[model samples]
Target: MVSSDDTYLSMRGGVSRGIRRMGGEEIYKESQDCRILNALSIGDVVVTSAGNLPANKIFHGTVIDWQLELFPSKKIIQKVVHDCLIKANHYGYKTIVFPLLGTGAGCLNKQIAWEIMLKQIIMDLSTIHQTLIEVVITLYGRETLSDLNWKFFINEMQAKWEIK
Candidate 1:
């Protein structure tokens, strides 16, 4: 079983490269199948109905807002991460995978983002047992991997899990 860590980050290659570079203003068309909505402050969970995806539920956490341009602030990101954990905690989800929040089109600093993410996750896990749930942060493509040093994340994970 994949062990629980304060942060779980990985690097992998992407199947297809995006046409445009990340961090510019790009419009995301909302389909009838997929809708975006405002997130309530309570538990930092954004409630969205069933989307085209197979998952019974899709939680939309706003990492970036055009009008507000909140773009994965450390506080906002932490709240979002916390909400996911709370959902998993209450719903009994054993494992949930997450993507790098601010790397794609969010214009965030990679090293800083990793540090902030790990800090919040460690804080969240302090209240819960490790056996209950595990989260994996998935990285897709060389661009992401290049910016985010995989070794840093791995080291953070080791420290959090008490691995020698």
Candidate 2:
């Protein structure tokens, strides 16, 4: 799973800690150094290797800066999601997984975050012609984001996409 962050050096909190566990300390360090040259602001993304994980790459998106805002704006989240998908397509990655961004330490409303994410994903997918890219939306760890109501989200997405 990819961790979301601001343009800061410290990699604390849930997702960042997960990255550290997955041997992504090097990637995090590199990202920090890269950020000095190219700082990651809201709606910006930074792609990195998944380290020892099964995924081919990790797309670190800067959705919110806790220091600046209490929660991320829906527009910013949508843009970040779009950017991540574009980056994934550019890298020829057919499959990608995303956590419920802006919900953990960013303290965004779970329902609102899910709605924005699903809407942006559906919109982005509709623009693609015949590409078979698989986008996976995961909770990362259920314990960490217990407030996220997945059942409601799945039902909403199914209704939106008319999925059987």
Name the best candidate (by TM-score).
2
TM-score per candidate: 0.59, 0.81
Give model 2's TM-score versus the native structure: 0.81
- Which tens-of-lDDT digit does each residue in 39-138 have in candidate 2? 5667678776777777777677787665677357898789878888887778777777777788777887777877788888888888864243687777
Clashing pairs in 1: none
Cα lDDT, model 2, residue 134:
82
TM-score for predicted model 1 compared with the true structure: 0.59
Worst 10 residues of 1 by lDDT: 1-10
Off by over 4 Å in 1: 1-44, 49-56, 129-131, 143-147, 150-164
Best by lDDT: 2
lDDT of 1 by residue, 26-82 (tens): 211221123334323322443332333333333444465555434567786777777
Candidate models: Cα lDDT each: 0.49, 0.73
